[model samples]
Target chain A: MPTDKEHVHNRIAVLRAERGVSRRDLATALGVHYQTIGYLERGEYSPSLHLALRIAAYFEVPVEVVFSLTPFPRLGSTT
Target chain B: MKGTTMEPTSRKQKAEALREESRRRAAERQQRRDEIIRATIDQEVAPRWASRAGRRRLVGLAAGLLALPWAAVVVCWYLAPSDTAMWATFALCLAAALGFTLIANPLMKVTRGVAGAPDRLLDERQITERLRAQALAHRATLALLVAASILVSTAVPDEGNVATLPSAVFAVFAIALLATVAALPMLIAAWRMPDPLPDDED
Candidate 1:
């Protein structure tokens, strides 16, 4: 089973692409480094709920649409 | 009357000055920590996620290593025939296990303390990054320990029919396992702790 760290799956890149937003633009909007945006998109780092909400807001989407706790799944319990 | 009033006023002024100085020193110390946190955060960003994973992996490795000596002791006790070789193997395994436990236990404690320092309250990113970096360092240490065990076991000859080689191999593995697994949860917990928001928010 994946650990808690892996629970928050981010679809940052997909959202950014869907919106035709460049990494620089997103980084600027988020007030973070562009590399941070890249890292977030790649799932190398998990964002805090605040950051997740911010990202979702930036993309004008629901937080769940941009992030999920479903794919990694909890260690136990089905569905 | 005027002279008596001036004396009290001067004493009050002195007390205020001392209080101000104490507050100033506290502010300076806080500023220093803020700078350190800033630097640590900047340095930690790229490597944070990788480090947490590393800590978990390392702890697991250490735990696995810890199992080796017991296995060796049991095997040696059963064989009974090769007394000299068994004793030597047992001693070596014990030493390795003890050495690893000693080093890893303290190392984990130190890391936890550093990660949990209240002075680190800064940007949330900074705290997260520091934790992640610590985890990565821990993982790297575990990897090194595993490699070292394999190397050392290979160097030791298998000439004696006393099961020395297996014991040594298992000892290394156990130590690595113990070190890795023991430190994993703590590292994760430290990493997962929420960073305090900026003072203005409070």
Candidate 2:
């Protein structure tokens, strides 16, 4: 049997903030309830591949830039 | 050109009017749907459903509501407190069981976890969560039925004559079992659902 769902870290919050797009707006664009956007931003829910792609498409970015297995580096931190 | 000239202007006007009326009605329907959706979300965000502590307490209360009746039946059967005590117990327990089942069905609606809710009522995430909850509830309900069967078997003699058991006892078990089975999916979903994140400046 497969393991429990692993957390899929995402940059959705950062991207939404940078774009000045409200969670409601993003949720509407993605055809999900606004709370779902919050869940995605908090890494509590891992979106399906279709939803992930749609979210990325909404922000005009690749899915990789939006979601990753590893956490994204802290903003402005040197590697 | 001859056909166009022959067509009645009044008939054309009536058709246009009908189309306009239909459009207006459709818009009104959409507005009502949006309002209902907003109301439902607001209810979900209310303190009773939003906070973990509150939800846990409610789930526990719902459980106790059913268990209390079941326990009373068992006690009445064993102690034979009075000639009509078992019947009385079944009657009272039946009321409470029905009450809880009624409340539970609606509570699931607020959480969008009602197994019978139409697909349009839930989003993808909620749909996925509900499906998982129902699957778990199905397995749990099976276990409960198995346990109940074993307990009821004890009441039967080597003759396997269930008639020896008071018919009232059957009523007690039936109400409790039916109510539990009906409410299991809702209870399971409510208990397993995580508290929604506090609304931050969203």
TM-score of chain B of each: 0.36, 0.65
lDDT of 1 at B137: 60
Tens-digit lDDT string for candidate 1 (B1-202): 8999899999999999999999999999998976665445334322323355554454455555555554554454345447764675567577656766554533333233344345334334545656565677687667867876696566655676443444444554564456445545445444443322122112
Over A6-64, each residue of candidate 2 has an lDDT whose tens digit, in order, gives 87889999999899888878877887877788877877778889999988999899999
Candidate 2 local lDDT, B1-202, one digit each (tens) = 8777768886888999999999999989987876675555445444565566766677777787768667766766665556667666866687676767666544654464444455576677878877887899899989988987897676655464433555556666676777777767777777776666665564
Q: Give the TM-score of candidate 1.
A: 0.35
lDDT of 2: 0.73
lDDT of 1 at A8: 67
RMSD of each: 14.0, 6.0
Best by DockQ: 2
